[model samples]
Target chain A: MHKTALFLAAALLACAAHAAAPKPAKPARSAADVLKDSPTSDWRALDPDNTLLMDLAAGQVIIELAPRFAPAHAANIRALAHGGYWDGLAIVRVQDNFVTQWGDPDGDDAAKARPLPAGASPKLPAEFSVPIERIGKSAGFTKLPDVDGWAPRAGFAQGFPVAADPRTGQAWLAHCYGMVGAGRSDAVDSSNGTELYVVIGHAPRGLDLNITVVGRVLKGMELLSALPRGTGAMGFYDKPEQRVGIQHVRLLADVPVAERPALQVLKTDSTTWQQLLDARRFRGGWYVHSPAHVDICSAGVPTRPAP
Target chain B: MHKTALFLAAALLACAAHAAAPKPAKPARSAADVLKDSPTSDWRALDPDNTLLMDLAAGQVIIELAPRFAPAHAANIRALAHGGYWDGLAIVRVQDNFVTQWGDPDGDDAAKARPLPAGASPKLPAEFSVPIERIGKSAGFTKLPDVDGWAPRAGFAQGFPVAADPRTGQAWLAHCYGMVGAGRSDAVDSSNGTELYVVIGHAPRGLDLNITVVGRVLKGMELLSALPRGTGAMGFYDKPEQRVGIQHVRLLADVPVAERPALQVLKTDSTTWQQLLDARRFRGGWYVHSPAHVDICSAGVPTRPAP
Candidate 1:
């Protein structure tokens, strides 16, 4: 097994997958392997209207909104972005293995906080969850073979990781890495989509059906995920200077045509996705044991530059 | 939820469980709640000999070695730390959603790398997986009731997160956030414990049994996880100045007794631990549905300031 002496080579997060332990004399074909052979039809382009171009000092992060799941929040977020709501705001909290929150730091103080722009609202109906039946055709759910402890079924839906209860015909977004959600108070209906957070580490699945999952970061996650964690409790920066200022959060539609993120995500219902799932379910090669199972968060859906 | 319009307050990752949404009108009481009632006997102090106090400019990170799983690798790591082999080294790679690597940046080049100290061996047999039967009484295995897709069983051994294959009677470390592993080439035995990395985001379980996992970072993970991600391919810094300098990696035994980390980890096999597990499996209040199941990675054993 000591074939290569490239110390830094194996340290990379390889996208390739394996077959099973005591592997055959050939390389095991996994996710990376399957993806390379996927048909072009399996990949879909991002919709500019439903996309966000979050420009920070480090780089740009692209997010895709889920209008079908949380219509009011989605509309408000789009309106806020259209009104240049987050231009001067700063990322205020980065709880390790949890989330990175951003908004007006003085949002709590009525006198000091930045007032909501014309299109933005102070409150909206809690879209924490919705009936699966209402999700309709755009829902696009593909349940995992393995059962989840959190939901009756777990899988990808409408291009977002989601958990569903077949018994109640209910469904909503699941909080996997890069998934975005609205920040709210103890009251379930408190969030107005002004403040938002991105899941930066573990998938706090418990957050499912408890908050408004607005969108997901499709690219440039490191810009937010790798920022210095807040020293203050729950990962809040102790000082104002530590927070990274948000340069602009323009909706893709508002940005110049050439400046938009030219990206595409693999469709969850495509044949390539099924191949990726199979490869993950039976990894071999360097693996001593084939998990024969894959976790909802661990099986990351691949994203790439549009060809 | 709009009890107060504290923007930053609601944005921070709050652990206070919700208690509404058709819930049982009572506190679900998970680890955050049961931890308050844990007995002193349920927690164990960190043994100086098995601990590595990694001093960085940001702060100190303490790692507890898993000697039971990889004895040779552990011994080599201890020897390297005791000899100050890693002092002045720099963290060279920070792959978001993957790992943070630290070691001799010139490790791959035989001409420029730091030589291993006297007691450290350059070549050690791979300890990727071992027969469970050989595990001594010190290796405590507590299997979770929920099923896993990765291994036959998921549990903790010697307080380290682990996966086991009962058929082959083998067990090894399960990759989780904070797990520390030696960086290697493609070779199975390329690592000598000098180049190491810690999981900073999602658990790359595919690396399990493919590399040598030595220990786990018990504290100061944010110091590594939150570092600026390198723009270079594979998250390596293109410029030498981008790396974070390491001060010293002194073994606990080498440090002055007065300066040791006064900390203890909650025992995994204790009744208190079981209660915490039950709480996670059946969380109710504020929860729309209790996921009677929990992932092995999500069931992180707690570590806290020793009373």
Candidate 2:
């Protein structure tokens, strides 16, 4: 019995010594590892109904529409897209450090204005916000801790940056660079989705919950963001010849399968995503110090090929 | 006595009536009024020594150097400019939504490298930050109240977005879109102002206090920002044929006075500036609702002829 007790004591001491000694640090993981380790359920396919493919001279830009917040605007946009309303329209506005707008340049004149194609709505209720309850239960939202002077609560929902107000039970999209919104005139409900603009500079959150944001340009932002600044007020092209003509805008499903570009977006709700965010938030090696927090707009959503 | 008391009572009643009656709202002032109202002391002309003019195919891009933050780098840059180092160089790097870089395309090869002319330094210290106390009063700072994720306090000083830490008493230029900085390799101090880059996307504040920000592109940003993205890594031109050759970069003083472009920047410290900020922060007419606060970056600095 004495020998057995002594043996147990010795084992305990050995275990304690091992715990005190430093162990080899775990190997650093690449961004790819974090995404791969994410659960399969976190991955979501792009909804064909909410996707827009803007074909440009260089390539195509994929836009993911947000109908949950801007239902009226999104519906009108869908009608316009289906009717091929913007098939040959030109990008008529390119404001430096502001926005790149596209529509019927002659829409202001009554006689020369292009009529809204059949099935397309000429008007839409400013669908800027919707009740928070209407947002899907599995939408995946992580609130940002920092204070945003523009919104009551700012964070990420699914893969997009969002703002919410519990008091009003309302939620809407926050205006970040690359975000797409419908252009309007003096009237609040003037937008019909035929005219659109994309934020290209600082996040114009003032436009948040004010205009109808339909979607975000996922890829090929350069094709639009790099256009020459217009000399006219609000970045409108003064000369009729200054506008860059659009060939066509078609849905990916409507296009031939061989022409469709294979693209994949990193799932925002996955643990891999959390790791990626953490990595961005906390810099290692050359970075002398790590930022304890990160703004939702600064956390970039990675894009690449699907396995 | 009775007459005096009656007169006093009547005057009091008139004052009370005036206070009770709602005063007519003031007329909306233009951005020009905002600058005109500013104290002359607040307005300072651009220093010819610290300014650079890059003549492009479209027009000239004026850049104001921040020597206080990057003295060593700025000095080297000034020397390079005076020596006409970039007279025959080329814009060889353009990364979409990232940066547009310009430098000697053959810089990497020791045998083919261009030699630094007289008064130019081959080596320079990484002048990323300086004492904050020297800013504003001495360095011409105009602070803005906003939450900056990268620094304790952030504001504009001498037409530049700046980040400062009161605790450490250090300040550096913030990396905003169109902001120009010297590029370097793995060595933190490798840059000698020969290679330079401009931020072309979302403000990479992560790079603040980590690099030498020389200046900002005051004009003709479209010429650089609109260039096609290079197919090589870090946006380097894969072939010599892909590079866009530089015409010349010179100080406005060096050019003939008749050739100088008439330009003026809005005085940031003026009352008109505050009014403009307020107008943008809380848009009244067209907007039904307005954001009470505005990010420092979102503020627009108008440039026009000095009327």
Candidate 3:
């Protein structure tokens, strides 16, 4: 059977309708096919120590912390999770075409605010971007072919979407869909990892280098993205009941090995990753016009269930 | 009082936490502030004949068709609405990070399919892009300052996101968030505007010239963006019951005058729109490192309820 249009269901059904039509010219391999042909070495399992499991009523959201990019924020998040700081908090905001934020709803009130857990600092140096040297010589940065408006260069840095400045010699995580950040106040050092927001819409590249991006959601983004939009200002829920409760958050390392999610991400440095990018950049299957360019965010890193 | 952190809800509450603190340094105006100061003439009311209201259990989605871009598809959609072709159909697909698609769930089955309503075509010459001359000299094309990798140039044509290639003398509607498109099969001219989908997540620019983008949803995007993801292939619901029922679809012109939504979109050619773009490109409040560029999609055309 002819391959389905990757983006549209109607196209899939329409292709089915032409069952008697002669086979069209052989289509080029798709990104899915490239992944299928990848070697096992091309995929890497999530590091439990740097992984976060956010449990909600709907399902678990797996986040891979990019400590290399924002070590302070990542460490703060670990401390908060270890202390069970976010066990009973709720997702208080779901802004359409923007972000879904979760933290303490009463955090604004001094009298009602929850105290920070042990080892978590209220004020820390903002890790908006790390020095190029910090990532080390073997950071595995796969540069994109196209230019990005937000940064001098954009590509994948160790499996995470990244933007870099050659002149400044600094690199930061790009705010692509599912990329998570530490929410801060007017002061650059105000964030303590208590408040977190994930990019759920278009790549808000403007946010790049302005906030401490600590990680990206690897799985179960649907749980956060599909939540009802909050009705109040900045998409804050009008009532407490409207907030979706976060049952608990745990470092995957803290969870039993058997309970940990079996997730694997394609290595950005692998040949298979390049093949996948090429497949997307060049037209195949149902694609008519070959968009020879692929934005770094659009060429998303592939993740899958472990075999 | 200070402007809240535009992207992070925690920043809003954090500002509240510092109520008694000394006033922070003066911050620059935000996009919201720019819109607040915009002149009444900078806004244009939606043309009733070109506007579509899709009623669902959640709420209504308002789409403004761009007849200047895809005349045939727009006319076919108008006819479909006139005959109530989509009155009882269900939204069959909700692909995370992609689109929310709706049409006849039985469209693929010849025996079960409902015939196209009177005057609606089953095939259409793909209006993927048009000669630049078609838009006329007064088309109000406001080019973006940043270069887009997907096209030679990207900007706002009138109030809609658009991409143009001056070398080819062609321009097309861009695949921005909330932009709606006609779904097609392997054949280039397979779509007839019956199966429509809306971009609900990141801007899938790769789909720009590959599909017929008929219009864009101006309001109530949360209604479509927050729908549950379909479990079946291509984000199609596995079971029919899981699909969200469409109460009805109607042209704003066909509705009673009092029943029509009083909506207005920011004119792209206005000085206020340019100021808004600059405000986003040159960050001030709560920003440490200013990203001096903004993608065309990020520089979204604003819309709001009429005064």
**Lowest summed lDDT window (length 10), candidate 2 chain A:** A1-10
- Candidate 1 has a TM-score of 0.88
Across A1-307, the per-residue lDDT of candidate 1 in tens digits comes to: 2211110111101111111333323344555667787899999988878888888988898889999889999999999999999999999999989999999999999999988888888899889778877545566677676545466567787678777776767888888889999998766788899999999987777677778999899888999998888888788899999999999999888888887767889998887776676566555444443454566777777888988
lDDT per prediction?
0.77, 0.69, 0.81
Off by over 4 Å in 2: A1-28, A32-41, A134-136, A256-259, A285-289, B1-42
TM-score of 2: 0.87
- Candidate 1: stretches off by over 4 Å: A1-33, A134-138, A282-289, B1-33, B134-138, B284-289
lDDT of 1 at B184: 78
Give the runs in model 3 whose Cα sits over 4 Å from its true position. Answer: A1-28, B1-29
**How do these models rank on DockQ, best leading?**
1, 3, 2
> Residues A81-195, candidate 2, lDDT per residue (tens digit)?
7777777788999877778999887888989888886878887888778787654456777666544545556667767888877767888887788889999876778888999
* Tens digit of per-residue lDDT, candidate 2, span B188-209: 6878999999987767666666
**Could you estimate the TM-score for every candidate?**
0.88, 0.87, 0.91
User: Which numbered prediction scores highest in DockQ against the true structure?
Assistant: 1
Error of 2 at A145 (Å): 2.7
Two-chain complex of model 2, DockQ on C-alpha atoms against the true structure: 0.21
Model 2 residue B63 CA deviation in Å:
0.5
Q: Report the TM-score of chain B alone for all candidates.
A: 0.89, 0.85, 0.90
Candidate 3 versus truth, CA RMSD in Å, comes to 7.9
